[model samples]
Target: MGVRVIGPLDAAGLDVALAPFLNAQEPTAAPYVGALVDRGWVAPTDAGTYVLTQEGVETHAKLLERIQIQRAAVTAGLTDDDYRTLLDLLQRVSANVDAFASTLR
Candidate 1:
């Protein structure tokens, strides 16, 4: 997703390329991707590939970077508020995943 989403700006293609990375049975991923598009972060090109608008792309990059930093902080054994923050973020991320899944269904 990081790689595919950045280059060419194709969130749809990013999802296709990331199919193998998903935990869904039989490589399901479109629902989440479609939900993302439906949510307005990406727009489809006539060729069927979607690109993030300038604002979406920038915002997505910032979010991805923050998530990476958070994961790294957890992996590095951060504790106290850092640990709690990570846990909080994990809960939010889980909820988002669930919400996205609901859209797919």
Candidate 2:
């Protein structure tokens, strides 16, 4: 999403770039745009446009790095134990989320 939204100089340009992830002509993209604003990953220009800040670029790069790492891991042959470990870790994370959510009940 950052990659799609970061390079545009204006909302129109952003709509074009974001076409793949969103319906550029609809209100469906507002949440995505709002999230970017909330995170300080993007800023509004005096011209009513948007641009990526330095932090956004840095964060995008780090996100790309993690994606590449995950892709590499998937392509690499995993031993049974490696798969088990990953599943176990994910299960633990899910359990933690459920536990935390339950507290808000």
Candidate 3:
């Protein structure tokens, strides 16, 4: 899924906004921003920032709705306890992978 823009933002601001969600640095995020600009999902401002076009906003909403539906479908029949256990296991797997990656570095 593409990044969602809430308002007008510069590249540096976008990098920061996306960091937690994407683990992306400015250089990485900038290209995606450019792609959005090219797609007409976002427009460059006179001030050298970008703002979502009306179409972008609508598309983002639809994307979010689709994600919600997918999440619901994936978690169907799972109780709260089951969900928590799944999350915990996923976190453990992520941690293990991070540890192994650190070794390679």
Candidate 4:
């Protein structure tokens, strides 16, 4: 869970970048754009391209909370049985969601 800087992207591109970690979680992107802009984490470069600013690089580098959280969770009493069950459950739910989404497509 090393930190990676992401652009001041529009909602769609932001989703693509965050999808790996954001699965099953609803992320607030629109408001984040404004917030990030305000904080100077990102900046608009053109009509479509948004670049990760210097602030973003430092911020992400400084933040490893996600990595720490996973480390803490694994340090907890999480056995292999619990791990497998969680993975299986996630897969099953994802499969169902994918099937439903295909219908919409």
Query: Each prediction's Cα lDDT score?
Result: 0.71, 0.74, 0.80, 0.71
- Candidate 2 per-residue lDDT, tens place, 1-105, comes to 234434556766766666645531363555677799899998888888877788988997998989978867884897778878987998799778767886886
lDDT (C-alpha) at residue 66 in model 2 = 98
> 79, model 4: CA deviation in Å?
7.2
Off by over 4 Å in 2: 1-6, 23-28, 76-105
* Backbone collisions counted per model: 0, 0, 0, 0
What is the C-alpha lDDT profile of model 4 across 2-105, one tens digit per residue?
54545556678876776654544356455667787789987877677667688876786666666677766775787868777978899899889877986885
Global CA lDDT computed for model 4:
0.71
Candidate 1, 7-103: lDDT as tens digits? 4535555766775466555455567767767878777788767677777778788998999888886568676698789889987998799779979
RMSD of 1: 8.6
Best by TM-score: 3
- Candidate 4 collision pairs: none
- TM per model? 0.51, 0.55, 0.70, 0.50
Q: Scored by Cα lDDT, where does model 3 land?
A: 0.80
- Residue 69 alpha-carbon offset, candidate 2, angstroms: 1.1
